[model samples]
Target: MQAVPNAFSVLSHPSLDHSGGGRASSEVPRPATLFESAELLKGGKIVGIMHNGSLYRLQATKLGKLILTK
Candidate 1:
């Protein structure tokens, strides 16, 4: 997986239907960090995320979803 610099950084992407033409006519802002769950999980179903001196749980559910909790 690739490293993301400044997870909060904003980037722009093409937007559609801004002028009701059904075409990309505008730009949309998105976070720079767009990561696949498997990359963060690192081949596992769970991983610990640390923030502000606190530990959090990041787990993959059996239904193929993610849940993060403090």
Candidate 2:
């Protein structure tokens, strides 16, 4: 039988530096909640979960178009 690969492993990469004072020249306007979600999606490195009356972000890879659960 073949062994299954671990999913909790994390790989690190070098940081990116932008010379234009951190802001891009062409930026699109977005909703505050959506902008926050996108930032959380990028920086959080995990998926967001909702439980009860509040929302929580968790660490898990997304699979296709299926719904995610914690």
Candidate 3:
């Protein structure tokens, strides 16, 4: 275990010096209506989310609902 450092010790670690002032490049963010685009969805109710060589399926149901499966 390690002891906690004071506020002055915060910058002791290396940093990328992002001009965005600490926004992570790897952070994936999107708007709530991201899948609302007809072109991306291709006029279908399904879309695939690829992660680590795996495909996740997102489907819009006939009841106007959503379902996700791996």
Candidate maximizing lDDT: 1
Would you list the clashing residue pairs of candidate 1? none
Q: What is candidate 2's TM-score against the reference?
A: 0.22
Model 3: lowest-lDDT 10 consecutive positions = 28-37
Query: For model 1, how does the per-residue alpha-carbon lDDT over 1-70 read when each residue is reduced to its tens digit?
Result: 6665554342322342346665543465444557878989999999999999999999999999899999
lDDT of 3 by residue, 28-56 (tens): 43322222435546779999989899999
lDDT of 1 at 25: 38
> TM-score for all predictions?
0.56, 0.22, 0.42
What overall lDDT goes with each candidate model? Answer: 0.72, 0.40, 0.58
Which ranking of candidates, highest TM-score first?
1, 3, 2
Which residue runs of candidate 3 sit more than 4 Å off their true CA positions?
1-40
Q: Against the true structure, candidate 1 has what lDDT?
A: 0.72
lDDT of 2 by residue, 1-70 (tens): 2322431121111122144454432553232221233444665456766789777655434542323454
lDDT of 2: 0.40
Q: State which candidate, 1 or 2, has the greater TM-score.
A: 1
Count of steric clashes across candidates, in order = 0, 1, 0
Better structure of 1 and 2 per lDDT? 1
In candidate 3, the residue pairs with backbone N, CA or C atoms under 3 Å apart (3 or more residues apart, or in different chains) clash, namely none
Candidate 3 TM-score versus the reference = 0.42
